[model samples]
Target: MTRSLIIAAKCIAFTCLLLAVVGVSLWSASRRVPKFYEHALTQQLPADELAEAADQLEQEVLDLQSEIQSQETWEVIFTSEQINAWLAADLEQKFPQLLPTGVSEPRVAIEDGLAKVACRYTSPKFSTVFSLELDSFLTETTNEFAIRIAKARAGALPVPLKRFFDQITARAEEANLSVLWTQQEDSPVALVKLPTNLDDVRSDVVIEVIEIEEGQIRIAGRVVPGVELQSMPQQPRFADASQPR
Candidate 1:
């Protein structure tokens, strides 16, 4: 009986040791888990990095928004009629001689600011090359010079041309449009006195080669101002027949 009791006590002791070992292992594991979690949390980004990330994202968004705003802001568009008017005005002002006489009405249409123009000439006048010169002088060259030339050309001496140019110059100035002349260095072939009004001016005003080097006269006012502008009307269908003399 004593032996059996002793075996039972040994069994109980072994069980108690196992329970103590298990308790110690659980405590060690618990301590390790907290340390590991602390290290992991330390490696994670802090508040400042999060703020930087937010700032970077905000900057990107702002840049995109700015780009969109700029595009919309520059979207001002011009109609075809307005563009054609500008071209016609420019042509009249720039190359008074090169511009065809009968181009009073220009048919204009615009698709996306690209001008499509069809103009009717009073008579089959100047050569195609001369007309092209007029077109180039208006749109391709420095428009500022054209303005000055327009102003200067009105004061020209070649009777009819002089009057025509003068009219255009006055019209431009009255409309608050101004031009600058670069050809001032080239002495004028003839000196045309300025007339205050279009009616007082002679119809003819071309620069005759007076004294090629000296720039002396047969002088007429550079431009003959104002006449046809009042006369030309926009008509839907125009007859192609020339007026009988």
Candidate 2:
């Protein structure tokens, strides 16, 4: 073979090898599961315990609703375990349509003022654990709060911000909640405004505080005289895994 032809052939082979390595690296990274998600999957709770957690969450929601109706000050706290139990045991079985398509097995971890929400995402191309690191706090506006998306990942690989924004927008629309998009320190933040009143309840609900701690979240608010409010959505009971499908 001519020298120039031999050099050209070597260049092509090198390019092919480089592409292969890059492809493999990306595939490996995509399959890497976050430690928090892995732990959530491995830890098994007894049926009775799971039921208790779900019940606690349900009762809290009901209490909050009752307080709103009575125009009283209210505070509700939820633990990570309680929320996870509700998500796993009740959400999918009862309100399957609540979550967008291709998302399942949702779980959350809250610590150091940040909440990590992870879920299993399945697409035709691949399946992976998708997670979002979020920081939520009350903004200056009344009943308004910001959930900043600090980072989003599919497994260990960083995912595009647009993907999460799209999902957030869809969810807000589905729930009839108002969400405004803005930037905070170069990170995307979703500003959520809680309606003062529900269609069925004419009392104004004013949210005053949102506090997050290790493994727990507390929200305190008050209800006063006002016009119409959008009724909050109802929650369904969760079926235990041991139960018949």
Total backbone clashes of candidate 2, pairs 3 or more residues apart or in separate chains: 6
lDDT of 2 by residue, 86-150 (tens): 98789988897887789989999888788989999898989988998999888766677878789
Residue range 73-92, candidate 1, lDDT tens digits: 11122333333434444445
Q: Model 2, residue 167: displacement in angstroms?
A: 5.2
Locate the minimum summed-lDDT window of 10 residues in model 1.
127-136
In model 1, which regions exceed 4 Å deviation? 1-104, 108-118, 123-163, 183-245
